[model samples]
Target: MSKQPLAPSVADLAPDDSILTPYDYEHLGTYLNLLTADAEVTDWREVSRVVLRIDPAQDPQRAWQAYSSHLARAMWMSKLGHRHLLGDIPSLH
Candidate 1:
């Protein structure tokens, strides 16, 4: 089985009102992880190392930014992105 390729990281992002980037599509799994971690109130330091691949000891700001951004994305996915998937699948013909 083939897996989806990862998305390229961007220099800046926020908890915006839209999900229109390839980053958004590619990081769905990461977002899910972040969402789960957030719901469980996991530590950001660990979430950073595991999910965002950042070392909080080396750089705290970027790590936090990545975690929070993806957490917001996870919320967006749960609230809105799923709506897009509801009817997007097509039967192979």
Candidate 2:
């Protein structure tokens, strides 16, 4: 029997048009990491430039909301990873 090739990962796929630029994705990933590390820290002024690059008119309220949502997702993923590490859950294929 022949084995089929594995599909590409999500990162391998092109970003959506709304998130086309590399800067956008990079900032997003950084923001997610930081959020996961410390949800209380909200000093995103450092990434203001990156956020502006993606949408100059991005409002602070919207940005905070988006960041919060991203943080939640990251936290959930981290918890899952911890569970897998502890052998409470199977490793994700």
Candidate 3:
């Protein structure tokens, strides 16, 4: 079996496209992690440090922007962006 692709490096802001982009595909794991963290009510600073690799202590604003934007993108992926993925499958029709 082929290995799963590793998540790409976290961006300062996730793409805000109406549909998922190649970057979104690469960051699927990251999005899931962010969603999990949100569900668990994890602290933003900690999530930023661990998942996003942004040091909230050194740059609070940047870290927050990155974390929030990424988390929002994650939510979008679950709510709407996933539909776009279905188009990738070869239809029997």
Candidate closest to the true structure, highest TM-score? 3
- The per-model lDDT (C-alpha) reads 0.71, 0.39, 0.88
- Find the 10 residues in a row with the least total lDDT in model 3: 84-93
- How does each model score on TM-score? 0.73, 0.37, 0.85
Residue 49, model 3, lDDT: 92
lDDT of 2 by residue, 1-93 (tens): 553223211221223232224322333454355454465554554333242222315566555555454444445444442343344332223
User: 24-88, model 1: which lDDT tens digit per residue?
Assistant: 65666778888888889999999888877788899888888877777877788889876766665
Worst 10 residues of 2 by lDDT: 7-16
Instruction: Tell me the TM-score of model 3.
Output: 0.85
| Better structure of 2 and 3 per TM-score | 3
lDDT of 3 by residue, 1-93 (tens): 555456567888899999777788878889999999999999999999998889999999999999999999999999998898877633322
Residue clash pairs of candidate 1? none
Full-model lDDT, candidate 2? 0.39
- State which candidate, 1 or 2, has the greater lDDT: 1
Best by lDDT: 3
Candidate 1 error regions (>4 Å): 1-3, 6-17, 88-93
